[model samples]
Structure formats: C-alpha cells, structure tokens
Target: MTRSPATPLPPPKARRRLRESAALTQPQLATRVGVTPATVRAWESGRTTPRGRKREAYAKLLKTLAEEEAARLAKQEQEREREREQEALPEPKPEPKSKSEPVALTPAQAFDALYAFSAPALVRQTFLLTGRREQARESVERAFQTAWERWPEVARDRDPVGWVRATAYEYALSPWQRFRPRHRHPEPPPADPGDRTLLNTLLRLPPRHRRTLVLYDGVGLDLPETAAETEASTPATANRLLHAREAVAGRLPALADPRVLHRRLAELASNERLRAAEPPAVRGGGERRARFRTRAAIAFTVALVGTTALTARTAPTHYEPPVSPGQAVRGVPHKVAPGSLSDEELELRQKLRDQMQDGPERLSPRLE
Candidate 1:
C-alpha cells in the first residue's frame, strides 16, 4: 500500500493556510505574488511548489504574517488588561491645576520633534544621500531603533532629533566607506564639463567646509548652530564659511555680476540636493555614538594599513638615475648601445658569452 501517493505532500502546509486565510480573490493573491491564479491553486492543492528559496520565502511570509497578527492581538490584550486594572482602582482627588495654556515650542523644540514626524525634507535627504529608499529608510529606522532603545538618555539630550539626523547621515555614508572598491572608478556623470568640474571641486573641499556651507546656507542653519554642530570655534567657523563662499564665488563666471552670481551659485548648491535638504533628527544616543566610534576606528585602521602597504611596496623599487637608455639593471649598469661599450666591458661580455655557449668544455683554468 503506497498510501495514495502520500497525498501529494499536502500543498506545502503554509501555502494552503495562507491562501484560505488571505480572503483574497484567487487572482488578487496571484497578482500579489506575481504568479497566475492557477499556479497558486496548484500550490494550494499540493500539485506543485514555487521551488527552493521561493518556496521557503513563501512559507516564511505566511509564518511572519501569522506572528505579526499574534503580536498585535497580544498588544491589544495587554492594553485591555491595563484598562481593566485602571477601572478596578479607586479614583484619586483632583488637585486644582494651573489655568495657563501650554507654552508654544520654539524652533529648537520643533526641530527635535521633527525626528518623530516624517518630513519631505527628511525623506528627500535620505534618498539623495543613500540613493535607495529602502536603504534610506533603514538608516532612519536604525536611528529610530536606537532612539527607542535609549529613549531615556535621548530625551535628556539637548537636541535628540538632530542626534537622529546626524546618525542617519553617518549610516548613509557607512556602506560607501565599507565597500570601497580599489581600482574601480565611479562612472562619470553625463553633464557639462564645467558643471562636473565645479561638482568635483566641491567634493574636494574639506568635510568641515562642506558641512558648514551645506548646513548654514544650503539647509538653512545659522552660522552659530552650524559651528556648534561642526565643533569649530565661532571665528574659525566664520573664516571657513567665508572661504567656502569665496571659493565658489571665484569659480563662477558670473561672479562679476552680483545678482547673476548669487543665482548661479544657488543653482550650483541646489544640484547637490541631498546636502541642501533637511534631515530627520537622530534617535539613538548611546548606541549610535558607539557605532560611530567603532566605524571611525575601522576607517582609521584601514587608512593606516593602506598607506603603510603602499609606501612599503613602492619603496624598494625606487628608480635611480639612468646611466644609459635601457641599460639599467637590478643592481648593476651596462651600456645601452654597442658603441658605448668600453674595451673592458666588451672583453667581459665576450668571456660571459663563451662561458654560456662553450659550457666549460675547454679547460682554460686561471690560477687565483
């Protein structure tokens, strides 16, 4: 008895349940999974499977949905329990409260809270910096996770949201630094040479200069705040601010015309949309700071190793002055042209050739 072909393996237990519980019109599930309804039906009937990782992922997805529903239900139950407990307790006497309305938050408070609230600026900045919405989301989410984990500590910080924004930016830059490929050049952007040159020049500026300019002018941070974020003295920050402005001013063709130059320079800054966009506040204080320090250490180590290796490998092969063209040896020199060979050299060459061709067959031993 073969047991009726083992019931065709029961349609991949997960898929059958997923199909039944989804309440989706068969075509809807099919469209969702990017397969035909008939194919989904076959999977449910145990006639076939999606195969390999696809099958596993399909199963995993069902399990994940199930878990999420369970967790949600549990949270709801917990909330119900809290409500019941509150209802069971005795009410306390109300104290007379102050009649003054709540104070309006300042710009700083608005900035701090902005981390929690999604903004066009945050979304735009993340996309520009990471070049992927998922990655940008992940960076922001990671900051959020950190912020949540250290809520107590982050709440105590002067600028919690700014902390989150900064963290996200650092996270966006992390992959660029980690997977830096050697000898692999970046693709050239299809743009005017002058524009490209100008962009490249901006990239060449020091990080402090770049950040200062981008923050103060581009994203609309004031100089004192920019200086604080950049950790530069106010006067020093002012000098860098002036220099960055001057540098860009000098490079612009229209600088001689004040209004035109201002517009052109603004346009130039606008091209780097990410740098100019506002960012989400940073969430995690302790963990983010630790991760930053660790990443920084790793970067420093890599730089040191790379520099040392480059110096060591190139040092031994340093070139000396050439006595003759194509005549330089590892540790010796020889005449490049036959005419340049001295009588002594010619005789030595002859003896060397004789030793190679004759192989010591003729016994002309010299007494030393």
Candidate 2:
C-alpha cells in the first residue's frame, strides 16, 4: 500500500514553531492574540487547541507570522550574500602605523567607550530607582557627563559602573525635581500589568528598601556591592532585601518567588534599555570642578567649626597667679611686712642676736 501524503504538523507543533520563528514569548503571543498566557501554553503543549472561529483565527495568525518570518530570513540571507561578495573583493592596503599613535587608550577614549557600553543599563537601573523614565534618562546623562569630566578618577575606580549607578541614583532621588511640573500624560504602560503593579508597589516602599531592592534585584549586583552602593552594612542590606521582597509579595503574590522576581526585574531592565535615549555630550568640566571645590570648602569650614566648638566645650581650664618666681617663693606675708614687729618676730630677732654673739667673727664685718 502506498503511504498517504505526509499530513500537516499538529496544532501544538505548528503553534510552537510559529511562535519561535516570530521571536515572541508565550505571554507576548498571548497578548497579541487576546488570550491568557496559560491558554497559549496549553495550545503549544498539545493539551488543547482552539475551536471553531478561534481555531481559524489562530491558524491565519500563524500563517501570517510564518510568512513574515520567511521574508525576514530571505532579507537576512541577501544581506549575508552581499557581505560575502564584499569580502571577495581585494582589500585595500592598510596604512603604516604612525609614531604618534598612542600605545594605550587615553582617559577620554576610555570614558567614551565606558559611557557607550554602560549608559543604557545605568539608565535602566536609574529608572527602576526613580520610577520615571525622563528622570532616569537625565540622571544617567548627568552621571556619565560627570564621569567624562572626571575621567581620570572614574577610569581608576574599581567599579566604574557602580560609580555611575550611584551618581544616577543620587540624581534621581533629588527632592528639587518634585516641585517641577510633570508631564500631563505619561508614556504607555508596560505590557505586563504585574510588572506595572510591582513597580508601583516598589515605589511605595521606603527609600532604603527601594534602593536595596533595585541594586540587588534590578541591577543584578551582589550583596556586598549592593550594600556598598546603598551605604548599608551587608546584614542590613540583606534584611532590607528580605523586607522589600515581602512587601512586594504582599502586593503582587507572584513576585514572592525569587525566580519570578529576578525574571521580572530582568524584563523591566531590558525594556527600559530599549526605551532609553542616547546620553548627552559631556559638559563643562571646569564648572563641575568649581562646584566640587565650593562644596569641599563649605564642608571643610563646617568640620573645622564643629571641631573647634567641641574642643572648647571639653577642654580643662585652670588659673594661676601672675606673680614673679621670687615673689611667689617669698610668700605673700613677706611682701606685706607690718611696720611693727609681732611677738614672734621679736623672739626670732633675739634668737638671731644670740647666735651672732656666739659667732662674733661672723658678725665683725657688720659691727665694724
């Protein structure tokens, strides 16, 4: 018997392939198809399949997606072929190295590379901290601009990303921005309601808790790094993270799982990166230096005044007579001798005369 023509792939296999080819997650696909994620998962798992009009619609969507995927692959292949053809052409001779070419990257070059590499993640991390995209962008831009101005110091730092992150966090947390007028309408919300709720809940937490959570979870920093960034001890940072998790779980039960929390944070960070703007150009280093010097001077003055006040308050005070050594030795009574001698003085004089008589040779010079 002749084998029947190969049947089409089952619904589960077809759905899975289409979803993968389209580069869509189950949740993303579900959102586009106006169905729950669990339903999409079930369809992909072969546990269930769409029925009637739902089935027809699902099949049509998958067909369209498959067509789009084929078109994209074709375009990609064409680009690769062009690249291969270019490679086939004879290459131009490279210019000889110049003696003036620096052997190492300059501070500016290093800072520019770092800024380009880190700005997106830094901005995303700041967005997690501040919960405002505009503020996060501004903060990261300012921080990197600072890094550009102080490239030498930042390049020498063990944790340059951490430095930029800390600066961004500081800028995002500034109170002055609260008084500024906010946009009447905000950007469209994230696709995930859970994520939006999680962010809202996080923002309601105490600043320390929020910062610890973002540094640890959102930025993927280790406990010690997070502690250092937040200026908290390790144990304290750990405790804050625990409390922050509990607080978030109270509002968003799904976030109670560590894995889920981590996944969500990764998603949020990635989304923010996609939405972030290019960092602004480095500004006047001189003005920044001047501001830094002014701050240092003020801090030094405050510290000096505080130290002097404390010393004065705690120091011992003692008073001594302003008399000469001779006067002090003679005693005050000798300095104020009476006009008439007392009985004791008379007795002392008689005793002195008797002693002089007994030693007449000693007394001869005075007597003569």
Candidate 3:
C-alpha cells in the first residue's frame, strides 16, 4: 500500500493533558524532544506547530502518553467491574456440619433487653418522685407495661428511654396517686437523720420543681433536656430547679453545691433499695389489663344499646290521666236521735197497733 499521511497533533488542551499525564514539565519534555521549553509552551498554547525531526519525536512521545492513559483508565474500569461482580455474587449456603451461627434478636428479645437496661434506673428515679419504693416499682412496671402495649410507637421513638422515663415520671407524680391510701403512707425514712431530712425536703417541693430538680440535678440532664422532658420552658425549668435547690439547701447547708446535691440525690435514691418487676411479667400484666378494660367497655356499650332499645320499645306513646284521688260513699245511713223518739212516729205506732187487729182467714177469729 502507498504511505498514508501521519495523524495531526492533538489540540492545545489535549497536548497539555498528554504532557501532564507523563508527569513531565515543559522544560523536561522539551529536553527529551530536542526542543526549547519556549517551543513546547508555544505548541501547548496552540501558538505554533512543530515540524521535521522535532515534530516526529513530539508526536511519538504524545502517542506513548496517550497509550499509558488509556491503559490506566482500562485498569481502573476493570477493577470497578470486578468489584461489582463480587457484590452481585450470592452468599454461600451454610454447610450442615458447620457450627450453628448466632441468631439476631426478635422484637420481644430486644424489648426485654431494653427493659432490663432501663427499668432499674427508672424505678429509682420514680422512688424519688413518690418517696415510696412500692410506688416506684409499680410506676416503673406500669410504664414498661404501657411501653409494651404501645411498643410499635415506642420502638420507633427517637428516644425510647426518654419515652419510658416520662411515662414512669408521669405515673409516679400523678396527683390522684397521692390520694390512694396504699401510696399515701410511704415507707420509712432514711436511717441517717440528715438524709431523712434531705429526702423530706425533696418530697415537700412542688411536683414540677421536684421533677425538674431530679431530672437536672439527680439524673444529670442538662437544663434544655430537663425542660423538654418536663414539658416546660427552659426558664421555667431553671426557676424550678433553683427553687428546689434552695429548699434542699435550706434544710441541709452542706448540699448547697449542685455537684454535692447531685451526689446526695443519687445516694438518697440508691439507699431506697428499689427493685423493678420482670419484663415478661409487666408485659403480661399490660396485656391482661388491656383485655379487661376492653371487655368492660364492650359490655358497657352493649348494655347501653340494649337498654336504649328496650326503653324505646316499651315506652307509652300517649298521655295517661291519673285516677281520681277521692273516693265516694256507696250509701247513707238513716239519722237516729241519741236519746229522744219523735211524737209523730209514736202516734203512727199507736194508730198501727189499733188498726192491726186483722187476722188471716185460716187462723183468725174475725174475717172479711
């Protein structure tokens, strides 16, 4: 075949790219290609073209650089394709003889784990709310019970611990709970007189203030978190906390420091020796309670409906006049004087005696 024309040099940008790909400066490239650095710059800037031996050498170098770039890109693409294939490969089946693998936890298992983790601390915290270990235990159990009842909502909550904590706190601090005779009388106070005094002071604070102080000073929550949990403004929470601290400090001057107060609160709570019920027990109780309430509601509704129907069916449609209240006498008796007889009645009686001499035909002496 006849000799074909050589390919023209790449554009300015491509020429620069090829040079940079080979990791060579313009001066180095010019030295290798037998040209001045100025000539290489002019070539890369598209201001001039090379010719003869220099042109041929420059073209050869650029072709090598292009081949190297193409090879590098191809290698990278190959590596990416291999990675994709590996990812798409199916996992191998376990052999029968292989040791059994660990199984992931079920929802119940996870819930139990969470309950075990949170319930003890919750009981202690609730004890501080009520100053009664029984109430605290019940509150924690009931809170967990509620959590189990509405577990789906609780599981998806941003903070499940906080959800249960709030529930327990609400239950423990309920105004109605304080009226119940069972919870009204709390267990004995701490053995230490000072400790007993501190706890009494804590219990005597307003419910909101106590809750705020317990969450902030006792539970180590920051002011914002305490406010959020207590459903109050930050300033309100701060104020309550301040008042609670002042009350406690008034009772015991040594607990004036917040850190010292925190420790004292913790110690007071720990000293209560509160214990929580088992998770399964709480869950079962919740289910039973829910069933009982549901049945009661259904029965009440049915009875109400039945009563309404019966009333509608048996009701009188028209007005009924009531019977006359007064009764009438059937007959009147003749009047009789108490001690005197009438003269006319006496004359008529004497006349009848004179005229009464008539006799019957069969037996009388005179007959007419």
Cα RMSD, each candidate? 28.9, 21.6, 25.3
User: Best candidate per TM-score, number?
Assistant: 3
TM-score: which is higher, 1 or 2? 2
Candidate 3, 319-352: lDDT as tens digits = 9999988655569665666776599988987987
lDDT of model 2 at residue 235? 77
lDDT of 2 by residue, 1-368 (tens): 99554324356767787787787887898777778676676677665557665566677778789889889999999999998989978989999999998788866667667878888777777777777787788888778777776767778665798888888888788877777777454656667786687678878998889889887777677786676567666678899999999999998887898888888987876765344444334445434665898999999999999999999998878776788666354454555655998999999999898785656553444554
The digit string of per-residue lDDT tens for model 1 on 210-299 reads: 556656655566665666566565578889977776776677544444355445435553454332222333433445776888999999
Task: Put the candidates in TM-score order, highest first.
Answer: 3, 2, 1
Off by over 4 Å in 3: 1-104, 183-186, 318-368
TM-score of 1: 0.36
lDDT of 1 at 222: 61
- Work out candidate 1's RMSD over C-alphas: 28.9
Best by lDDT: 3
> Which 10 consecutive residues of model 1 have the lowest summed lDDT?
3-12
TM-scores, all models, native as reference = 0.36, 0.48, 0.60
Candidate 1 Cα deviation (angstroms), residue 84: 22
